[model samples]
Target: MRACTFVRASKEVVDVADVAALVKADLERARDTNVTFSRHAMRVVPVETTCFAGVDEIKEACKPLIEKHFKSGREQTFAIAFERRSNNTLHRTEVIEAIAGMIEQPPNKVNLGDPDLTIMVEIVKGVACLSVVQDYEKLCKYNLRMVAMTKEDREHAKATANGNAPAPGTKKNDEEKPAEAAD
Candidate 1:
């Protein structure tokens, strides 16, 4: 589908956010150059690996991801965000709980409100696309338009691409901008 396409990059691309950032930059550049079709993308979801939609397959796929992101014994909060389309064989709770059970706790905790890392599980048909991503919630869950809509979101997205933090007070929505007085 044009709206969503699965992209598999070489090992140099670390996470979904990285692909999203690359797409965002390319889109931004296209838009700046007045490329009309640059506005076509609405969301950009990235995945590190794919597996058949089964508990065992998912567990096997998640091993390396869990090791890379959580095995260092760092205190990081995470959440499992699940999305399914044209697939209902796997229960959401079951999949989430299964993945959650695999990660070691105490050093790592689950924070639904705001997680430092997000394990994105997208089940399209019978295939499962998985990725451990940072700033999932912050980037509007990888929505291209939302991330590129405002100057602030753009700045934050850019910082995220460069592995930096957004400047303080840049998270405000467009509606929250100060109104201009009538001339």
Candidate 2:
């Protein structure tokens, strides 16, 4: 499975395993401590993008998908966010207008603040990763991923997965729950 790891460290220092560890730890700790956690920052979700040469290209590729995925035929809020990376000629407003015209209307009008549906267009090297989101979440600052667990740390990870409490001197303050293990 192709996976995208999301975290707050440089690409040089992080990988999928690190993100997975964070996910496992977050879930386990949340389970034990009765704390709430959102997959928003710690899980992988589908992100769709379409490649195009310019603004017109984006419209052709993204319009139909936007229509099908937009689904908010009024009674809902929606908005579009645009980003250009590859020395494009068109303006941001033009991109917004191109895509917005396809989805915006009536009660489901443009609501930039807390929109029920957020369409994001991120263009890098002429490739656009445009996606529709009901719940908007972002990667860590500067899109940094997670830091990894060292080899010496592997034993502790195995112990936790086996439903054992963390090795002494290895647990975080919030994960120091003496009441339960693998809750």
lDDT of 1 by residue, 1-183 (tens): 325665567665553346535644655554354342445676666777899999899999999989988988789999999998888799999999999999999889999888998999998888999988777776667665655556665666667789776467565353376779999
The lDDT for every candidate, in the order shown, is: 0.77, 0.56
* Clash numbers, per candidate: 0, 0
Off by over 4 Å in 2: 1-46, 72-74, 137-183
The alpha-carbon root-mean-square deviation between model 2 and the true structure, to one decimal in Å, is: 14.6
Q: Indicate the TM-score of model 1.
A: 0.68
lDDT of 2 at 99: 86
Q: Residue 179, candidate 1: how far off, in angstroms?
A: 22
Q: Any idea what lDDT model 1 has? A: 0.77
Estimated TM-score for each candidate? 0.68, 0.49
